[model samples]
Target: MTRRIRPRPRPKPHPHPLQLYSLRDICTIRILRFASSPELLEQYTNASGGLRTGMLMEHLDSLAGSIAYKYMLGPEVETLGRVQERGFYIVTASVERLDMLAPLYPVRDIRLSGQVICTGKSSMEVAVKMEALNPNRREETLMLGRFSMVCRNASTHKAHPVNLLIINTREEKVLFKMGESARNRRKYAALHSLSRVPPSSTEAAELHSTYLKYGQDDESLALGDRVWMGDTLLEKTMLMFPQERNIHQKVFGVYTYQLGFANSCLFTRSHVSFLSLDGIAFRQPVPIGSILRLRSQIIHTSPPGQLPAAVHVRVQASVVDVQTGQEEPTNDFRFTWTRDDGQTVPRIVVPRTYQEAMLWLEGQRALKMGTQIRGSRLQGRDR
Candidate 1:
């Protein structure tokens, strides 16, 4: 009898802001085959074979948690409370799906896999791949997307160094490469827009006074040191339903904000570590089966000392009826970040106008309230 030596299982990696699963972990992935179960359709999704964007976003939240558990924390996800004063930013999000045929009998199935693609000094990049898992059938590529988040000091809301990711497998390497390329593209794009998008004179005035108000506030929460501006294209299949009561069924304000949060975070080279959402209101309704195009821009940044080193971003989602080529305003949201450091300051020039300032002030108020409400909702939903 010959004795053979077996290789030892690799030690579980240390905790880091950006972490990837090993090859063995990727190999063991069992593709999940999920369709709109009859119950699921009857309970939630519309009859046109399209689910609400909010519902889709909720699913992504669950998926994010799953990714966090499997890759970030191995067997036991560390206990980190709600995104309170410090946390990560959601930079971008998009649903990867196969084409819909007749809405009732959608063909392809999608399996989403996500991981931290890279780690900046104070930020982390995550990539998610939605692949069609058809064992015996041929299907087209579904969707590919990535997000960036920044971690902040829990107390000061200042930017701080975070642990780098440890990559060990081929699949992880591939995702990492893709993230690098995407980030590089972002840098190139930013270089051309070095000059700030000059705000109208009135807008400028508002920014100045708005800072004063935040400066006056005693309960300010800063999430990051910098503000970012960017755009993300979300591909969604909108199914038309003639029987529904309202022709325009607006997407949830909260959902669009969160999704924009993910994309903007990624664009800013930050993680979705700590966030507060507020003043979420659905102004109007969006018709069913409309591709909602979302655009977000970093309008301002507060330094780490004024409050917390954080970024102020404004986002807008517009629903486009692809068939008719008509668009309608769907949602508008504002997001703020608290740096990790205890020292909160102004990172960007605060606008200097009454109206613009008032708007900023309102956004701040809404963000505060939104953060509390959204955080609670996220926690409750998770549980």
Candidate 2:
């Protein structure tokens, strides 16, 4: 992919603090830790008196940016002036993984921390953890997320090299390996995505069996055993504003994530706990002032089981040009949620069209991979 490169002018005598340090220096200063007061949590709560997942996502994105900036810029040193004088911009490329281990309540104070765990030439992987604490109590981890960010020249929008991460401690080394594994998994999944190639023989056979089991005809639709593809789908449109743009003058990836996640939660309309978010791929950059159309659909639901049923939803965001009447995809998000009541509903999505079937199958693949990844992480932690 070719990126536009713009020429950057020489920095003036005074440069911003963001341009000062590398990841090494930034890690020492604890640049990615943020604390929110209980009052602040109260302000962010929804009508149901619970903290919204969208708000948490917004904070995670910001924390990821801070870590990326520090990794790219270096630590503040007055005597050394500025480590790198040229100002650069960083934007989220993708959110590889975000798992909500526990829900955050309004009574608890929130704390977030992020650090650069892996880096390429111009891209870095940031691991962000969110914790909640009650009055005079120890902190408990609520959620964890990983973000991939790319640095670019402020003017040209082309990729820029970032400082390499220095691994010293055994823990840091392990984290670095984890990040590398995540990156490799992402790459492999992308290369094997259904969008890139046709399904294998086994996958094709599975699809055929799925169609035979759940495919609805006119008579079946009337029986109410199946729901229309349009019935469970939800869509929202909003204009991207400058206030939500990042330093790169483009809409922040997290803003789109917040919109998609909130809409999915609303559509489910059940007391559901956030499980995981995966396959979040940013296809294109959303320009400021553009109209964004977000569409979400319940693609799959868990079978009848003793545990709470899991529902998988897919959200796609596209940029619409009002004058030209053209729309292009910007990002794709897949989220998994489990019913809080532990009620298993034998709900299966019936795709009315071939396009819908493709989407449904894609969601199935994503959910399987997400489950595997979560299981592997748990095993690692236990070890």
Candidate 3:
């Protein structure tokens, strides 16, 4: 794909305790000449003729990394250079969230942009945005997301400090604060994660209520229009290909994101509309040739509303050790989806096991947050 990069330059050096960078100094804008090239849009179009969100995610991941690397390696450098020679490499630590703002029309030219808005001792918060350009030169926001990236020393495999951001304007402070808040939230969420502690009392009570309603049926098991979470699983297994490899020669996280979106569609058997993706954590780097297993499940369902219901799904990406027969999980993806308004799902998702119950609660949390976010956006727009 041909790209038109927005011009940028760095007035600083090319070393460790890197120079202070303005937010604009690290910004990267890529124009996908879709309107000019009709032939290239076929691969990125979904079966329904809309832009494929999974493909957009791949671009976001790539753009975020490019912005991060530019921050560390300066704008004059076009390539990642040599990993070992450069001393450090960038990796996605986690994705805070990605929200669909407007419909992504397939025929429109899209612009992808990202910049390092905030930085820590070693980590950076890269904010990415997607906009669809119209014939009159108007742009509509299509998607917005934040990526947490960290640098690692190539030799020691330890956290490597990156170039600092020199926050100048009020807008820059707001962006920086958002990143700071996200980091704090991650720390808080990790502490309260199900792996480290039991469910809260309120969550336990909710799970008990679910058990009384769904688990009491001994014969049909699903006495009502609700199915066990275990029954809603869909899996995809594939070998990591060289084409999906990132700058570090590791399978890109975007592949996992795409797999999750595709698998979620199969779970519902519909052309699901995307709402949001949250709480993505990349635990391990998958080698280019590793075998990948993606397990997707419907973890939560909001009670039927005007739209019938909203499904909250989770996909776990794992790498299988061919020799030892071991499956080590590498990432977790949470997404929210629904069909067009007024359509209803056949059944609600219910958790029977304690483990699944915990996941149910986590998905519930994500759904609630996504709803609030969209609600606030709508409110702001209405004003």
Number of the top-ranking candidate, with TM-score as the measure: 3
How would you encode candidate 3's per-residue C-alpha lDDT over 114-133 as one tens digit per residue?
A: 88888999999999999888
Q: lDDT values of the candidates? A: 0.45, 0.70, 0.81
Candidate 1, 1-383: lDDT as tens digits: 89999999998642244544442342112233446355544444443454333343344434543443344334344443344422332222222111111111233455556665666676555554445656676543333334554455444556645454667778678767866765675565346322434445664565555455543434442533322122123223344344332211323334454555555454445442233332122345556555666665554544334643455556666777667988787556555544434444334434334444444544443444434544454454346
Residue-level lDDT tens digits of model 2 in 247-332: 55677645544554554455444667778886578888889999999888787666436354677788889999899989999888
Number of backbone clashes in candidate 3: 0
Q: Candidate 1: which stretches are off by over 4 Å?
A: 1-36, 51-54, 65-75, 78-109, 138-140, 168-171, 194-383
Candidate 3 residue pairs in clash (backbone atoms < 3 Å): none
Report the lDDT of model 3 for residue 189: 89
- Tell me each candidate's TM-score: 0.40, 0.81, 0.90
Report, for all candidates in order, the number of backbone clashes: 82, 6, 0
Lowest lDDT block of 10, candidate 1 = 95-104
Ten consecutive residues with minimal summed lDDT in candidate 3? Answer: 215-224
